[model samples]
Target: MTLEIVVHRPSVSGGGRRVTVGGVDFGLARGDGDLVEFLRRAGLDDADQLVSGDSPIIQWRGGRAHEYGAAGG
Candidate 1:
């Protein structure tokens, strides 16, 4: 089965990010050190340096990045 992960980097919230995998929202905030650490253990990279124009980089079973970007206005 293929896993889908959505990484949201909202401009206003800083690093209060959200990652959704297979419709399950990982309501993980940067403030929650334990949760972030847990996700790190699960192979998620640190997202503190994200910006508005950044793309949602994804990693999969084959270890390749699926570069997804927002639609141009």
Candidate 2:
């Protein structure tokens, strides 16, 4: 199964942007660096998998979703 990275822009309270992996909110991100850190902490290797356009869509197998990436499996 493919996972979708849903990003919520920073709110008016000055809270950093937030991202969710596979519908689960990971946490807030101040910028690209913070986003990457969150993704890594969530066990994602290639960040391209989170790209919805241009990037190749990864096909899912019978295991965890994050295991797949643009390279396909």
Candidate with the greatest lDDT versus the true structure = 2
**Candidate 1's residue-wise lDDT over 1-73, tens digit each?**
5445554453243534455555666764343353345345445565332222243443222212222222121
Work out the TM-score per prediction: 0.38, 0.58
What is the overall TM-score of model 2 with all chains considered together? 0.58
- Residues 1-73, candidate 2, lDDT per residue (tens digit)? 6777655644445555557777778886555566667667767786544433324443222322322222223
**What is the Å distance of residue 60 in model 2 from its true position?**
22
Model 1: per-residue Cα lDDT at residue 58? 35
Off by over 4 Å in 1: 29-73
Which stretches in model 2 have alpha-carbon errors above 4 Å? 48-73
User: In angstroms, how far off is 9's CA in candidate 2?
Assistant: 2.2
**Residue range with the least summed lDDT across 10 consecutive positions in model 2:** 63-72
Query: How large is the C-alpha RMSD of every model relative to the true structure?
Result: 9.3, 11.8
